[model samples]
Target chain A: MKAKILYIEDNEQNLYLVTFILEKHGYEVCAATDGQEGIDMAARILPDLILLDIQLPRMDGYAVARHLRTNPNLATVPIVAVTSYAMAGDRDKALEAGCSGYIEKPINPDTFIQQVEQSLTKQEE
Target chain B: MIACLVKACMPPNITHLMGFFISLIRSASAYPFRNLSLFVVLILLCFEVPPARAEVRTVTVGVYENAPKVFTSETGKPSGIFIDIIEHIAKSERWKLRYVSGTWSEGLDRLAKGEIDLMPDVAYTADREKIFLFHKIPVLTVWSQVYARKGSRIQSILDLNGKRVAALDKTIQLETFTRLTNSFGLKIILVPVPDYKTEFTMIASGKADAGLTNRLYGLMYARKSGLEDTPVMFDPAPFYFAAGKNVSGKLPEIIDRHLSEMKINPQSVYYAAMKRWTSEEVQFKLPLWLQMLGLGLGVALVMSLAGGLILKYQVNARTGELKLINQEMEQRIDERTQALQVTNSKLQVALENLAVAKEHAEAADRMKSAFLATMSHELRTPLNSIIGFTGILLQGLGGAINEEQAKQLKMVKNSANHLLSLISDILDISKIESGQLSVFFESFNLKDSIFKVVQSVRPLAENKGLFLSVEVADDVEEFTGDVRRVEQILLNLLSNAVKFTQKGGVRVKCQRNAGNYVTSVTDSGIGINGKDIGGLFEPFHQIDTGLSRNYEGTGLGLSISKKLVELMDGTLQVDSSPGKGSTFTFTLPNVIDSV
Candidate 1:
């Protein structure tokens, strides 16, 4: 079976970009437009990895990370926070809120797959 | 003489005669012949002496115009100190005093001729002592003084030379004056007056320039007669109750006895008599030492009172001056306090204005930070899509593309990347200026960081056919610093080198020197002018505005690199010459002591 990923993002273009990139890499791409939908989908599908956008509507990525961590079904899954807040301390903030990894916004397509794979491999280890 | 004899001899003779009679009668029976003779003699003596005690002796006391001492009073009765004492004695002695009023000279003459039995106020003199008898105790002490007309210049005996001076006729004062002037060789003419009144009247009328008289009479009448008493005084004498030498009476002796008895007692009639007759100044008649002591005490009291008044005046003056000075000082203090208050108020206003300005600046800084954050998100979100889609297309992930289309798409992707980097540089400088940029420190390899930067720019250098070389000393291998920021600085320097050099080569050198990591990037390219070197590190500064078209750049790379190097406690410096090349070197401390 293909490794499953859930992408939580508010912007449709960011969601499409991440989905296309992950799908082309042979990972099954699942979509959630908001933090709450991402959490529900994460618990139900029990995805192999979660790609989270920090600036989400209604609920943010950090809250979604903490919520997803609380569900036993999704607790072991890796949650990676992708954010446009490239200023100091943003990565630490995302990771402290239960994200397993952090990536800055305007994601470089060249490194995005590698970063996600690193998180999945880290979770498996 | 007969009265004296009777008075002296009668009392004893009578007592002896009676006693002999009784004794003879009792012894007649035993010795008849001798007893008969004694008895007859006793009886005859008793019969011969009449009743002497039964008869009162009459005394004729002479009074005169001499006042206070003996003159008759206004009531027409003989009333004077002399009569007062004499009557007191007369009452006790059972004697009748007969008053014979006369002039002083007449009284003296009467007493001398035995017409008056006693005369009072007689100053004893050798000439009078021949004619009158005086007792041992004196009635009073008197002195003679010269009296002159009120405005006359006769103040002493020397002033009496060639001047007519009047004196009482036959008086001791007159006799003494005559002898005194004559002995001094003064040719003063003499005017004899009958009494003190006449002498004073002659001097007052200017008949004589001055006159000699007893002090008692002068003190009494000189001022009334418009006369001044001169200081020329003489003849201090004792006055007595006097009698004619031939007069047979014990009046002078009796007066002496009474006066002597009165003198011993302070509360006696003698003191009363002196007080009544003499002026108040002479009444108390204190001892000489007592008078001196009283005068001394009086002088001391007056002097102390004067000194106390002066001290009090000076103290008051000083206190007034002190009060004025204190008031002035208080006023100055008040003025100073007011000035300080004004300054304090001004300072408070300035402080308030500064606080308000600070608050406004802080608010504006907060808004700018918010705007930077929002721009980072908004600008990058669309760029994220463009770069992602273009990158996906260039990779032929969706479909195969022709070579020409792929080349054009690569160009578009390159332009998009430049735009993204421009946005990123703008964001970085903004973060630096806003003091929001922070570098993370870790143990990183210096050579690896430089190798990675050189690798990123290697393809660009190969496309331009420029030789790129890197030399990192063996000791410059590992350093504890911000790995990401170090790589960023190296990448900016290498890319700048590759971009500028069209034909020549670029070289990078890293070495450890003085506990610092010194890295230099040197390029051989179209050189920079000396004038442009100074502004090379300023943000958005370009060497040649026309060259900006030929070279696509953000114009912020060198400035960002310089600032980043400075943030790591390092220095960035450059050297260049026209038509030659430029060298940019920076040094970072090998060990960061503090963040």
Candidate 2:
């Protein structure tokens, strides 16, 4: 079965761009526009990997990562931090806040699909 | 008859003696010579009769006072060594003694005016010598001395410089002290104390530095007061009794003889009187120390009451001072408190104004974001149509058009492309303000991405008839960074160079900038003015907006480029001068090395 990917992003255009790249790689994509909904959707769908945006409404990507880590059912799921904040130490902050991997936003169509596949495969192993 | 008369003139006793003497001479010379001898004897006897006795003349002696040596004293009456000698002369030469009594000045004045015959015990000073015939006898030697403070340094008349010496009002000692002190150039303040005792007290109490008194008086005072002897005596001149210049002729002779005789008696009455007066045998009994202590305590109690009154005044003064200080402190506190309240109110007003400003800022932000979304959709839709249709047409989808028509179509396509870029820049700025813009990162070949940017802008450079060159430095084969943002920054710079320059070439260079790769685009274009360089990266800031009208793009390119560079953790810098072209550079960290 194709690996299920959950994408959390607030910007509609960015979400369209990311989903277009992920679907083209034969991955089933579930999108949540907010961080809390992303965590709830991740639990329900039991996605193989979650691509979470750091800046979102109501809940942020770090909070979602922490929420997913706390739930026994979703504890093992791999979460990737996707953000536009490319300042120094952002990656370490994301990782320290419970994301397994980090990605910058404005998705590169080819590279986005490859990175998501790599994260999902690594989770399975 | 002559012989009988001669015999009658002589006494019967003499005639009998003469007859016996005649019988003796007649026996020798015979009867003839015997008659002549008897006649000569009778003649010598008549001439030898004794003269009748004259009565004794009585000389009158007068004296004002029984002067010790010159007058005698008997039972407190005037009878002394002087009187005894004077009575002996009076008995020998027959003189009467007359006694008188008066004050010393009165007696001296009477003697000087010739009212009295003589005055004894007078010192014959030069002034007194002018009016009096003085006897040579100096019956007593009185020395002048200065009785000073105990352990005083004063020793002689010269040492009396700048010192206050006290003396009696009118006495022989006063004249002597003044004359001697004046001769020595000493400043003597002759204080007339009541007596010698008081004068000693003046010196001891420091009222006077020293006292000028007779040596005898000073010694007597010192002995009586039990004071230390600070005798400063010198220049012993003699004291003698003076008689009037026109006295009774024998009066001076009588005084002279009396004085001469009195000198023979060594223990004279004057010495006895002085010894009696100055004797230490009659000591005065003083009150006991306990009695003096009691009197001192009484005085101290009176002084303590006065001290208590002064202390009350001091306490009142201190209380007044403290009250003044407290009032001043309160005034200062009030002023500071008022100032603080005013500052607090001003801050409150400032905070309220800041809140209002923040609300407006947020609203403006929301409106900008909404407008950006609508504008983005509107602009991109038309741009897509234009670019899509032009692509088809240029690809010969409508059958090959003429070169002129194709060139025109391409021009239209470029204009549409520029408009789309302008709209995109605006949208990006709005998105950045609303915090919706995001950066994308990927592992990519840095050289490949730079080459692609050069290739894309090369067409425009060719269209502008300007040479465009890309020189990638050695050892920079691959780097991990955001390719899309770097491409955008490079394209904006290159496009501006192409748009502004009429002829000169444009060059793109990449070099290592510390830990980052610095990419610069230098253009020999119609260069930006030096003054406008700072505004170059601000949105809607164009040099001469009217000149920018000829250029077909909104002035948001550099601003959007700067924002995009910042989002990728880089710096965008520009260097330019008026008419000297421009260099736009930016730094991008090599992603692999950055981590």
Candidate 3:
């Protein structure tokens, strides 16, 4: 079965861009507009993988990752942080906060797909 | 005959002799015998005479203890200038001599009463002349003077006004003192001391303003007591020895012959004796050897010191002359050194100019490569779009699609327009580097320009779901400058902010700073690392090589902003930290007044 993905992002353009790339690759995608909703949706769907945007209204991506990690049912789910912050050490910070992978924005379509596939495969292992 | 008479009165043996003697007398007598006998008896009686009364001769001598001319010696011997003269006259005259030692009053008394033969030293006052006859020879002239304490304020007779004075009683000084006191209205305190020592001590102890005495005696007292000499205020009064009126008949011959002779021979027996008795002889001796030695050494030492001082002065003059020459040479060297330093600095400045030019040339070479790369990419984008759309059309991929197919084709036309904008940015940066881009300055509201920038970047921020806030500080009022360029700089910064900031917010602030209007764009987004800050404003220099592939840009925004700010006579500055945020600020001159 194809991996089920949960995408949490507040920016509509970025959400569209990420969903388009993932759906085109034959993955089932679920979306939330903010971090709180993302946390709620993840609990409900218990997706195979989760894609989180660091910058979110109401709640942030780091909070969502921590929430998913605490739930026993979704504890082992692979979470990828996607952000426009390309500063040094941003990826390490995201990973340290319980993300499986980090994707920098002005997103490269090809790299974004590759990283998402890799994070999903890592989860299987 | 008396002897015959006695014989007649005698016995019979003598009577027979007497009768025979009577008959001899009758035979020789045409003269009476009795008368002859009586005449003989008378001759005998006259020759037998009564004893003579002694001669009553008196000698007068004056005594005044304080007088220098006539004073009693320390040994109680009567000796002075006048004493000597009187002793000589007494010896020459062979008269009976007597000395009446008493006060001056007593001497005057005896001379007036004719009890004394002479007064040794008395000035002939009118009242005195009426009672006594003076000798032709004046014994001495004595100046009467005032004696005051050392450092006393009594410099002149005028200083004696209303001041107390002391004088010896029954002295000529007393008369003179009285007259001066009355004339000057001085309060004379006549202290009749027994001697000059008492009088001098009284003045020294501040008991009197001054004491009146003969000038000679005052000087003698000062010398004896080691007090300083003071001048006499009044004229000198001449004094003399005087004889009594009873002996006035012999005065002229005695005074003329004897006194005049003594005056001629002043250094004779009398004067020598007086000086010896008065101890004036001691003053004529030579000073002791120790005192002479001390004085000679002092003089020789002073002469040697003066010679040494002169030699030092000559050496100092020579040293000063050499120092002046050295200073002149040093000043010349200093001037030459300063000139050489100026030339060295000029050479350094020229070298720095060359180095800066080389850096710019290298930067231009990189920019040319970046520009060519951007140009090829920009041209290929539209060409690829156009070629794809045209190939699709040629293949009838949109066959019979009607209005929908044509509308979709117009979207490709919009994508082509976006590629044109990328080419435009490259061309603009090249124009800026070549010095071909110029700003058109005009008066405009600075806040309005900043608002335009915020509005232009707002859609992009919204697309990322990021809050965009614009704040104009109250101090930033309307200003005049190059509005279009200012807007362009602000737009570039806000665009960069929206591009990086995927969350949180982008803020544009406008404020007045110093003399300029400042605009700042802050983003809570992907911040530039500190290591990259230095190269942020260099054209075509981004933080990482792969940044261009991840984020879309020519990497010329900050360099363009900085150059544009400088052209407006402003400064562009950036502060950023990795993973935190970045703030970009630029200033424009406030040209409101000119507007």
> Best-fitting candidate, measured by lDDT?
1
lDDT of 2 by residue, A1-125 (tens): 78888988887766765675566557788999997788788888988888888877788777778888888888788899977554435676789888888865433332555687778778879
Better of 1 and 2 by TM-score: 1
**Clash pairs (backbone) in predicted model 2:** B59-B95, B72-B78, B72-B79, B72-B80, B72-B83, B73-B78, B73-B79, B73-B80
Candidate with best TM-score: 1
Model 2 chain B poorest ten-residue lDDT run: B52-61
DockQ per candidate: 0.50, 0.02, 0.01
Query: Model 2, range B211-286, lDDT digits (tens) per residue?
Result: 7665655555565554555546765666655677787555665456555544555684434554544454445665
TM-score (all chains, Cα) for each model: 0.59, 0.42, 0.31
For the candidates in turn, chain A alone yields TM-scores of 0.95, 0.92, 0.93
TM-score ranking from best candidate downward: 1, 2, 3
Q: TM-score: which is higher, 2 or 3?
A: 2
Best by DockQ: 1
Candidate 3 backbone clash number: 0
lDDT of 3 by residue, B1-595 (tens): 7556656455443232343344335434556766677556544543353323123344656676765677777888877777776666655554456677876777778877877777776787888778888766666676778878777767777777766677777776688778876787766556677667777887777776677777767756755543444555675888877778786447545655565555557776656755654543234334678678878887888888887888889889988988998898899899999988999899899889989988999788767856654564446433443634443443344345557766776576556545644554565577676665566566777777777778767777887899999899987766766666787688788888888787899888887777777788899988988878888999887678877787777788778879888887789998888788999988777655434
Tens digit of lDDT per residue, candidate 1, span B222-280? 87788878889998978888887877756677677667767877887778877776673
TM match of model 3 to true structure: 0.31
